[model samples]
Target: MSYKQILYNTPPTDAINPSLTTTDGTFRLSTIPKPSNVPADKLLVRVHYLSLDPAMRQWLTAKRSYIAPVELGAIMRGQSIAQIITVGSELSSKFKSGDWVVAYSGWTEYALLSAKEVEPFSVPAGGRPTDAMSVLGMTGLTAYFGMTEVGKTKVGDTVVVSGAAGATGSVAGQIARIQGAKRVIGLAGSKDKCEFLVKELGFDAAVNYKDADWKKQLKEATPEYIDVFFDNTGGEILDACLARANRDARFVICGAISQYNTSKPKGPASFMTVISQRVTMKGFIVFDYAKQYASAVQELGSWLAQGKLKRKEHIVPGGIEGAPQALVDLYKGVNTGKMMVEVAPVSEALPSKSKL
Candidate 1:
């Protein structure tokens, strides 16, 4: 039997903007032999869904970052949901062949993963197992920590979220509302996305950053100015949020996707406002709060069950063959919410084991 995998064949041209490109040889897909013998304390997993995130592009860069970059000719790094096909005798007491887990399994159809390297997860109420990759997953955890720990959102504070239609930003805005923000405004890229943010996601208002009058709309949406800014799209939107920041505002720098694709990286030009407004600006990674993930997931899960939180996802199908296109589409902002690719379909019709 053969299993497919995607490899890192070409590093990006620049370090800062390591966006995925279709230029020949950027990524290569190949078939490899299936594992014939699984080792003890290890499980053979069939990959199901592979998360497509903006940060995946950044991981290609060899720059000094929170984490190391993927090496040349190595498997592309990604978080995925996989089903156990077979488990080692040492691990059989704790796990079964049908059990599901989320792991940093990279871009492969089947992998031999140790139990310690993956986490067993169950679907939260109002969330699917796939949510372990999206709203109820690391993205949700990022929003939770970015809002409560870093952004310090408070009741009646006016909040603003950039890239609000994306996975992290969308949940960040709603969590702001759940935190009792008086007004929650979002910055999205399209009119439909703005509408989705305001109508479906329950944001107080949403501004289309692509609109010519975006600044005006942002101003109109937050008349009292922003007390907390959860910034994802950094360049221009970061500057705009700074200009509208109220006194004693907090800026949680979760990501800077806007500048990711550019040749020259840019910073917010409105630093002066940070001084004038007595702002508290900081950047944080969710890994820093790893210890509290379980508790945070509990609270986020409750909100999701109570309808205080919402998420959207764009999943590209076609098995491993669709992985490259999914990354390309994600960078183009072609996905409205959490973007991912289906490596193998989750099947429920199997006799005892399903969800490959």
Candidate 2:
């Protein structure tokens, strides 16, 4: 069978942001033979949805990162949902044909994935199959671990989050509230997003960084002093948060979206505050906590199932053709929640046989 795949070629140039362009180049639809090594226990998935995250930009660049860079002329890496069209020889124990599974299948329409490479999720959860990739997947896990572990937030403590309206930040703020935080403050670039953070997401306060008096407003909004700061956009915002941190506060550096595109990365200017406040700022890669992923996923799933948590996802439709642009949109702040692309429809087939 023939399938479409998106491949990246050369790296970006000085004029172009590789994240936005299919630098290298994009292979629209390419035909390739099906893998002959399919185990009976492995299922073939026709990818339906793919996630576009800011991390993808880092992956596109040939730089050291938590994950390896996408090889030249290979399919652009991404997380996707696919339906089982064929079963592998080893599949009889856990999964069967026609099951829907999430995998790191990249921007391809079809993928030959083993059961170990994918996880089964019910389609249309909260009315979309992509939610699994958003709130129920890595995004959710990031928020959960960043808040519970890195931030170590406690009741009656003030928490500030940069990139407040974005996927992980939005979820982190809400999780802070659920965990008994006294105040949850969000900072974003636009007025609309600030309003949404305060009105819809239940943030105690939302500040628009675009305002001329943003620094003053942040100080006023967080008068009690921030006990924990979850920084997603590391730049001036990070510096500002450091200045306002209370003694012994924790700063979780989840990402530096602001610095990703810059030619020369800048460091926080207010290092002196760390000495005065005795702050603890630590950077974490989510995979470092992989040993606890199952427990985190289970607890997060339970919260979603019981309506204790809400998820937001910005889904771009089309197939692998849409993957490149979706990744570019992430840096431009075009996505409000977890950014993802819907490659195709999810599978609705039921398993005909079960293995013990």
Candidate 3:
């Protein structure tokens, strides 16, 4: 059996699918027909790679969020790299078949989107289109603004990043170092991931959050206490960082993957530490920095050239068929870096596997 697309379904709590891919209770492959023709205002492209981010989990909920939730039976929403297969007559002058671009292509083998919905992407010097999905893409931009604009990392600041081995958190930690933070420590799930952070990624040290002595490990890692906390996991880690926060430290809340699956998400028990420590805690969405993206990209691209920034992408198998389980595996910490699915051939070179 084959499918032209995949559809979003009721989540685990409200629904479930027995298929192994949909075991997490979200999506299922569908046999929808491909569009016979492209509209004059839109273009059709075959998806090459689709980014699998933790944020996609939040998009499944019915609750009010930064963006509207996906409606059941609709295409699952996502971003992807694609080669234009056809362009509308109106856009033919500017875009053509075979032109590679990025767009909100959803979880399908092909996407037909408006000219405004798809944009061209030029691989920067020493960078590949795959980087667009990892470092040079949303993951990188999220880290850029979260560190510079929100965290305001300084030369003397001792920075701590939870979920430090994941895409956004990994890049966020490096960006903190690039911005001159005195010490950069990471919080990861396992000893191997912790070693990856400290040895491969240049983190000053790392704490395995799953370890029995992790809290003591955290204290030992940040003796001067944390001046900036870049959080991707928000439960106990957030509470721990709150208690260890230096006065007026900045906490950049990029995500809360730890709480995404829980019915009653735990609020920080160290809530009073925010008051006592006079900490500045803020949650941010990447789109909030749209106006400043160009500058961020320029600087990030330069770092790519200078070797100051590196990236890790975990490309799962089975093409588009692999996406649902790949997403499910994200919360399982199966991927040590950015997670993606290659539905078709990508135009850029990617490392055989993530170094971290």
Ranking by TM-score: 1, 3, 2
Residue 136 in model 3: lDDT:
82
Compose the digit string of candidate 1's lDDT tens values, residues 128-187. 768888887899999999999999999999999998999999999999998899999999
Question: Candidate 3 residues 150-243, lDDT tens each?
Answer: 9989898999999999999899989989889899999999899998898888999999999999999999999999999999999999999898
Each candidate structure's TM-score, on Cα atoms with residue i matched to residue i, is 0.94, 0.90, 0.93
lDDT measured at residue 74 in model 1 versus the true structure, 0 to 100: 93
For model 1, where is the 10-residue window of minimal lDDT?
347-356
Ranked candidates, highest lDDT first: 1, 3, 2
Better of 1 and 3 by TM-score: 1
* Runs with alpha carbons beyond 4 Å of true place in candidate 1: 14-24, 348-356
lDDT, candidate 2, 100-179, per-residue tens: 67787887887877677788776444435566677777888898899999999999999999998898988899889989
- State the lDDT at 223 in candidate 1: 94
Could you give me the TM-score of model 3 versus the true structure? 0.93
lDDT (0 to 1) per candidate:
0.85, 0.79, 0.84
Q: Against the true structure, what is every candidate's RMSD? A: 2.5, 3.3, 3.7
lDDT of 1 at 185: 94
